[model samples]
Target: MTYTPPAPAIVDDIVSKTKFDANGLISAIAQDTKGVILMLAWMNADALRETLLTGRVCYWSRSRQSLWRKGETSGQQQHLIEARLDCDMDAVLMIVDQTGVACHTGRRSCFYHGVTPDGLRDTAQPEISTKELYGH
Candidate 1:
């Protein structure tokens, strides 16, 4: 789906209200339409702006040191339904319509681990194989 960028006045208000961290980043929590948390990622000011502008989930890749648009390579795109900011504006919560899996490991969610007596354990299994998702 194509999304047009919002007006300059609206963009200015959003940027002005956010409070990015020392690294100029904010934690963005992505949740599915059913209210299940899918993943946690970092977003810089530019990432936030692009996400808001394009209605696509975008993140700051700390390891790659660049902007990472979710599902750009894999077909697991996350279409943003809404973007919410925390009270202090230090974090963001994104309601999204996720296509396919949200995890790079081909799982529905990035959070598939649980703290158990055996220590960290897999709480869920991948719906699709990573090789199938990434075509590796």
Candidate 2:
């Protein structure tokens, strides 16, 4: 189910309660409705507002220094199901309905690597080629 925007008062309350880091950003963890973790990204106040207002997952791209709307370029959009602020109010947890893949490498999730006593190992293979996903 898609998320509905909270009341303006509620939004104001959330925005006020949140604690952004010195970089003016907070960690956002995206998970599927089934509780499967998808990926983690950073969000600034604007990004958080956009996600709440639009029900689409938006993030702050430190590398790009701009807003990064999920699935804007690739067809892998994340529709917000629910958003929760951590108890400390320093991070956010986003539950979403993911379309296509969540990982930039075309995997279902970004956490495809597993670290074992042996070493780091690839746990999941990419479903689609990154070259194709990005048209590179």
Candidate 3:
């Protein structure tokens, strides 16, 4: 579906309220409509603005030092359902409709490791192989 962005003024107001860190980044969390946390990433102002403008999830790639559009290569796009800020405005919560595995490991969520009595363990298994997700 074609998603139309909000008015430029609205976008500006929202962006201005976000408190990016000294590195010009803020934590972004993507959750499904069912309230299942999918993944956590980082975003700069540009990434957040683009996500709002395009209705697709985008993040700042600290390792790559660039804007990363979720699922750009893995076919796991996240369509934005809603975007919200924390009380301090240092974090963003994105409600999204996820297309496929959210984790590069091919898991449904990035938070698969769990601390248990038996030490850290994987709580979930990959739904798709890494090769299948990335064509690597």
Candidate 4:
């Protein structure tokens, strides 16, 4: 289904209130409608603007120093359902309809490790294989 974005003025108003860090980035967390946390990423102003304008979640790739559109390569697109900012406006919580796995490792979520007495342990298995997702 095609999702329409909010009006430009509304998008601008929302982006304007966001508080990005010194690096011009803010934390963005994506969750499913079921309240399952999917992944955490960063977003610059441009990324935020694009996301709000397009209904597709876009993030900042700190390592690549460019806008990273989710699922661009992995086919695991995250369609924005709703976006909410924290009280401080330093972070955004995005409720999304994920197309596929949300993690590079082909897991349902990026948060797969659990802190245990034996140190971190894998709490979930990958639903899809990385090789099938990335062709590596």
Candidate 5:
């Protein structure tokens, strides 16, 4: 499907956006200008607000139980170039000026490692190591 950038359509003003409901979870996708998907994360409204205010991707981490600032420690920050909501308003997509690697596994993107005939392999590695950034 062709992804047309989302904006406040004329009808959007009259439409009520979806609420968070009982769960504070919303799906978020990171995509490149070329329409390549980089990663997926979860965000609460606060994270969404923070992403807008700070121009940085903020995600609600189910594992960490807190906001996970993209590239906070790895320096692979995603500079929020644009944000879009799905038609259902239950998901978000972020266009970003990504830097370094965006994956904790030291890959340029979380999608670096992929399925292959030989099962799984490290198809890519970051230019720098995570330990190099945080000091192992």
Candidate 6:
């Protein structure tokens, strides 16, 4: 988190030591400083390096076939405070200091929809438009 060594070295060490599943992907959860779940994504080695280099959230876009930089177009950048790998090294927890909205829908967090004790619930609605954020 505090120290981001050169990519090649870090990648080599982690890839060689970390126990990755067959998918070669790691689950990553984004959280605020106060431990609020903001969102979840996947991170490949490339994404990890990108995030460390830029101090922003970077995730692998399986559908898009590319790396997705959080808030690039939406101006909802997450300034990383720390990145922690789980004990098993199969998952990551990203603690960040967010700027603007974290959600593409102009919400503070992406976990707006929730399943409560009563079952599924639409906890919140979009505060702004995707068009406004992405400029379609």
Q: Write the per-residue lDDT of candidate 2 for residues 1-136, one digit (tens) a residue.
A: 7588988777777888899999999999999988889999999998998898889999999999999999999889999999999999999999999998999998999998999999999999999999978888
Question: Candidate 6, residues 1-136: lDDT per residue as tens digits?
Answer: 3435446766567655655567667888989888888888887877877776667788888888788898777887787888788899888888988776677777777888788899888777777778878898
- Give the lDDT of residue 93 in candidate 5: 87
- lDDT value, candidate 5, whole model: 0.74
lDDT of 4 by residue, 25-53 (tens): 99999999899999999999999999999
- For TM-score, candidate 4 versus 6, the one ahead is 4
Inter-residue clash pairs, candidate 4: none
Clashes of 6: 0
lDDT of 1 by residue, 6-116 (tens): 886797689778999899999999999899999999999889988998898899999999999999889899988888899999999998999999999889999999999
Pick the winner on lDDT between candidates 3 and 5: 3
Better of 3 and 6 by lDDT: 3
Worst 10 residues of 2 by lDDT: 7-16
Q: Model 5 misses residue 56 by how many Å?
A: 1.4
68 Cα displacement, candidate 3 (Å): 0.3
Model 6 TM-score, all chains together = 0.82
**lDDT of each model, Cα atoms only?**
0.90, 0.93, 0.93, 0.93, 0.74, 0.78
lDDT of 3 at 34: 91
TM-scores of the models, in the order given: 0.93, 0.96, 0.95, 0.95, 0.78, 0.82
Instruction: Indicate the TM-score of model 3.
Output: 0.95
For every model in order, what is the number of clashing pairs? Answer: 0, 0, 0, 0, 1, 0
